[model samples]
Target chain A: MNAANSGSDMPAWLVIERVVRSHWSLSARGERDAGAVLLALWADDRRDLGEGFLLRAAYLGASRLRVIELALDEAAPAFPSLVEIYPGAVRMECAVRDVLGVQADSADSRAWLRHAGWPVDYLPLRHDADRSARFAAQAEDYAFVRVEGDGVHEIAVGPVHAGTIEPGHFRFSVVGEKVLRLEQRLGYVHKGIEQRFSQMDLQQGQRLAARVSGDTAVAYSWAYCMALEQLCGTRVPARAQQLRAVLLERERIANHLGDLGALGNDAGFGFGLTQFSLLKERLLRANAEVYGARYPMDGIVPGGVATNLSSQQIERLREQGMVLEAAVVELRAIYDEHAGVQDRFVTTGRMSPELAQRLGVVGLAARASGSPRDLRSDLALAPYAGLGVQAAGSAQGDVAARVAVRFDEVIESLRLCDLLLQDLAGGAIHAELGAAAAQQLGIGLVEGWRGPVMIALEATVDGRIRRCHPHDPSWQNWPALEHAIIGNIVPDFPLINKSFNLSYSGQDL
Target chain B: MLDILKRIARTGIVSEPQLKLADLLSERDTLHAEIAGILGRALAIRQVDAGSCNGCELEINALNNPIYNIEGAGIRFVASPRHADLLLVTGPVAKNMEIALKRTYDATPEPKYVVAVGDCGCTGGIFGESYASCGRVSNVIPVDAEVSGCPPAPTAILRGILSALASPRR
Candidate 1:
């Protein structure tokens, strides 16, 4: 078994000692206190573990995953909600209740994923939850918050959109064109991915992970594979690490380019869209030529990547990188100087740094809002550790801020791609990853283009995946989108939505 | 802004090589003539993502990009299903999304066609008939044309769109 140093280089504050792990095996009250102390001390993020309904929290300072087994067999499964400490835990708490039947004593628990499809008592992710049962379609009136005043009205948009985007219902409480409140309901695309993971072998689970969000396929697959490799004690080759980094950076550049164009289009700049879209198409075609998939789906597997690149392909990629950089820099100037775009973007959908902190906004959105937390730099995992990554950020946290962040990231990623290709080492791109040990827990966090994409894997004795929870940065950023639009006019909704561009499928899974 | 205009002038007509229907249609003899006759110079499409990974949606979106230049081919996506001539459905119809997909299919006028894009849409790719998923697009509604790829290329999706237009009316 290849144990390439089990996260030993993490900072001292980030380390959760073995004693802390055992401390969580406590009475419900003790668990609540422990969670409070963890949040107060260092924990920055929360994730719902599908196995045993375990609630896991992690830190960006030092790479540590603290699991609080909420459902102890001896007692009734209940724990004081972490919402008091980490307000971000509210959604995770509701999702855990909806999926795993573990209750968090939070004020708002109106069934997150239930979505009028599942019965009140039915928990989809529970081991004993009957799979054969069919749910007849029904529409339950979602209790959207009311804004009653003179000229106040409510506008409901989508589960089916006019654009070629995914499904998510958005309710806007508006006083004329100005948005008073914005509440979004997601989970229309929930395909039971967590339960599906248990049925597949470890390698198949990697494929499933990539599909969690197609745009961030490399991020999800890499996170999943990283978790599995750590669990099986497999050391990925240096060449594989280099290739994975290349793919990841490519994915980042591609998504950011597309988004930058869309954001431009949203702000009524068709010239920016056409120019940026042309540049982005070149990148996609280049990706298809080099990686064999436009989006890098299934390119990353359990042990390592699926394919190796020849030096000629590397040269082509480097050339494309140069072209893309020039085009983006040219377009960035256009975006900045254009009065129409600036007028719409400058203060529209403003989110203050303090509000971002309070809401626990994450990923690119968080970084744009003066939160300089980046997993690549903060958690310094391999390839990234060797090649120092500077986090791109802005203080504004508006549509302009997000756009600026994307442009900065695109340029940085292109530079990284060139470096990765130049520094490509010679070796096998894949390692032989064997069966995972029984009852093992593995966690992987990757800084995807949008933000941090995290995956927690648990394997059974027979090497089958016990449970896999692929968490997207969208989980944290989606609520920030709602908050970002509080004061913006209704017409500016599309522009704001495009700027953030949170994934419905990623969040739904 | 002046720089952008100058750049556009310098690189006159930077659009990628246009996709000819003849070359694409020659590969499939089934609906080549019929689709061309029916579609003429315009086809209004409405995209319904039943439960895709958004891979197919990205590719479908790519169809509208400058290089693919689908608009030049006289195909455009409409906001409303009622205004659509074809329904381009992607993803492995999830149980939750089944009714919505059907409602969309039913909402479209009688002469409309449904083209299932992506392997998932065609045959429920990886996440197959499970408790939460209803498998392929055909499982929920009749699919006239099946474009098979994990997420088919933009050219292939366009072909699927054409084939569905040419498909026999039920």
Candidate 2:
């Protein structure tokens, strides 16, 4: 993949050709013909750029990420919508329209992120938008697509829930018990994270990035730092790279452990919940003792990691990892053999491989339905490039398949961590980063435990952050959950939801 | 099922003896004296995520784990605010959720204490007062006790809960 010269003013067509020929390239094109060419490449994965309203498309196989700078000189702040070609572009375009006051030239232009919080004219992401201004509170009634029928009934759940969970509204149109359609309304957790990102310096940005989603803090921070390091042409030490891998795997283990527990609990199996929760708790304690923070919030900083693991700490983690493996192996057998658990899991909330592909489902959810796209294996960086990660996948896209994929990934992550710890390279934990070039853009992509997390970063000449967009795997998988819930009874929603375990705050940001 | 029973038998009551209220509760005697008559030894908590990073929520969930055994300490997380004696709110209040948070507070019966958990709950943490955010939990509703870690550890959360019970307002 050619790292296209930012200084070179390449024509839009040539830039597109370069990106198509190579796997990945960063090319700069003039404002003219940017939207037309990008609209031509509309079938590819395209996302909204920051407040500047540029369009980024990753053409060919999910490998090349190309950003097309839209000409803002038009009478109205509008760009051609890619929704006609790529179905996934609907929400991405709507989000940009909702926050940055950019419009997409397509129908179904209802707001996505803005939920009766701000005045219709106020755009929060714009530089001139008032941060402290308060809008009068009003009751919100979202126009959820109605299903008119003899037996169709709507059941609204959450934004707050029965269980202690993050807030999001789930409006289910149902015929008796079976769900006909499920529409989700989120952004109840949005805290203006993107606006806050611009207010922080390069180093401080990582701390804010880590909070994008607490569970995937390491993944988010690593991706943000990777983008910054790329802009500055800074290479992290080999040892630091290995340590980052270790921490990432540890995070994966902890989340999988917790999700497995919650899934069991949702299925009415209390024993599984207790056992798996205990396992997750032990791993978290180990994280606190060894890595400083229970969750590795401030662990990964720009140019490298914030903390270094001593040999003694490494030995302890390895021993604990082995013990965890043995325990989980035994637990898996019990979960598999238990008749009641199997009954609840099999064929429940099943999604076919074809539907999953059409919906662009990703991460563990996609792998369960046999999509077989894992960023660690596909876009291997650093230790993962040589580590040979075995992407966990299953042909069946049911609750059972999701659970099985999680189990397989947990085992794989444990093995990967052991290898990373044993082969600890000798070098400084962090490398001093040089000054970043002005008006430069860099992208960092990491396979977070949930799925792929991509961070696009732009820095000013003086090294202040211009714009940072942290894209969560939740954006791809949340719609998949709506599909997963179809044909299943209302009671099974919690179980099915836990299997995917999409992050609300991550997506809300 | 038999295997599960056998495993449980082998484990043989892994739960530690319930800690004395004085040991876990902050403001020990004051909390015991305040809640001893009305609430007795039991307290039902309803947790609200005003607008959090979910890090604080993770620690809140940790309270339910075997080590902490918050239930064993006579505090349990309830489903609805109507059933709760205390509201454990986490994050800075997002503008979108401000109404819902206030509604939850309104719905709760009298003698309901609110313990603001984590730094965000205490003072809005990193995402302070902004157009989209109202800063801290107190900015939206009255707070009884404030816990102040980026995500206060599970123990800190329990202490905060205990302190809320001790507050004379309750």
Candidate 3:
């Protein structure tokens, strides 16, 4: 097996190597409460990457970073669960158990990512299990932890929401109108993306990554392609890199616009929704005309990008950015001055910096709560390194803080967009990439609008994908939601949830 | 409030002019794309994400924007399936979401129509059929019409709904 070190974070890499020091040099064995476990997932080594069965786990940490993993064989098919250290790792550890049959020693030992839709032994990711096998709908009865009190009662919200949103069940324990606990039951949108990735070649997998979560298509696809290019040692052109930046920034702005409006609407401001929706529509129309897709799902491909902007098109984009900046500034003022909105937003759904740090929250939500860990700014690469990126954040850690971060980012993105247009890289838009070598593994990480979207891809001897694990930031942040809603009232849960906007589909897979 | 009103007035109904279904006919879209205003009565739609990538949801949400201004037309998204006349479902039906989708479909009253939005809803697009996916919206519930795009644009999606509404009630 190629223990190709994922040197995305160099400091963490050294720590990981030291912690998991052994012959194979990867073991989280007997380390029960060893720091925060960012992601705990296992790959079936019977397919490739090794000769026999294998298991692994690693640290995707920013606070007191430490890495640990154990290479499991047929005999030792379990690893010590780090759910206690990384409180966020509970769901991931459960997911690992359900899909791969790799057990973990955690107190909250429960099934995740699967309801009774499949057989109890039906681990689709296991080597012995048939990949295309189907299962009948069995009885589903997930035992949600109940709160025992005189007046405390449960309020089940969804697997289906009121609006045109994704599906996930929220079980809220309430007394009167104030909430005591909020437990989220996701995996309602689990599309078997990880298993599906093995069936596709690298090019086809790029398309699958785009669909992992539709909102952050540019970021996901770029991360997938980056991993592929890294494996093949293909150098992307300067112009293509710049264009990818343009697409990524635009994607970031569009999502922030959507969330910004939703935040206001949640607090009962119709004007905010109307004005922001109008602006978003204008931006989307421009995207369709320029990138040929409103969401630009196919914008970023392996070697470079699929499309390029003309000088006139670039100029038009700059103009749109300027207009958006002016509109956002005006909207921010209205949101700030408005009494009803501020009353709802200010102290409601607050998570302190310490709680955020302990839970290991990453991405925009983390930044808002005062963890300045942005991949673009922290690990400045080609485009982001050259065109300066100022990470927008606040220490308040409320709906208002998240709003402030979004507003700051939108303006910064506009500036970056204008800068990119002014200094458009003059070269070929795409570079022809060669085939991947035998038994190669590579890691690709991008700071998506939500947080770091990482794609760990490994190719077989003949160059087909053996295993591809797409890690979403939602896995870490979703647990933070459970904590964020602690003392907040039932009415403010929606606003708090919107502030985080964690992805069900991204994490479910 | 004056600032809000002035800004609203300045923006002033940027909603697109609705064309008759005949004028909107392309060789490909001629079948499903229909006139939006034909259903003069307001439409109450309950959108279900059977298991979409949420690309379809993004565009579906776009229908609310001023330019498309879906409410300006007779169509509006409702809170409950019981209140809905049409079910706008998206994504290839994931196996886990199948039972919930079925329950939701059952909750909506009779004479309701279903329009599966996006390529996934239509034909299970990219992540076709898997252990986790039921492949298409029709796999769980009956579908009246389908709009196929990675995510069909807001206009195409609106037309698909209107077209489904044009059909005889179930």
State the interface C-alpha RMSD of candidate 1. Answer: 1.5
Write down the worst ten-residue block by lDDT for model 1 chain A.
A37-46
lDDT of 1 by residue, A1-509 (tens): 12212453222223333223334334223433443212211111113333233455543332443443322321344556667656666777677777766666563667666677667777667666787766766676777778899999988887889899998889999998899999888888888888788779887898899999988899999999988887787989989998999899888987888898888888888877777777878888888998887777888888888999998998999998897788788778878888888998999888898888777677899888998877777767778887778889999989899999998889889888899999999989999987686555577778888888878777888889877888887877788888999988999999999989999888887
Best by DockQ: 3
Q: Considering DockQ, where higher is better, how would the candidates rank from best to worst? A: 3, 2, 1
Chain B TM for prediction 2: 0.87
Model 3 stretches with alpha carbons more than 4 Å out: A1-42, A47-51, A61-69, B19-41, B168-170
Best-to-worst order by lDDT is 3, 2, 1
User: Which residue pairs does candidate 1 place in steric collision?
Assistant: B120-B125
The CA lDDT of each predicted structure is 0.77, 0.79, 0.81
For model 3, what is the alpha-carbon lDDT of residue A295? 91
Better of 1 and 3 by DockQ: 3
Query: Which stretch of 10 consecutive residues in model 3 chain A shows the poorest summed lDDT?
Result: A12-21
Tens digits of lDDT, candidate 2, A212-315: 89889999999998888877878799999999999899889999999998888888998888888788888988988998778878888998898898899999
Model 2, position A457, has a per-residue lDDT of: 77
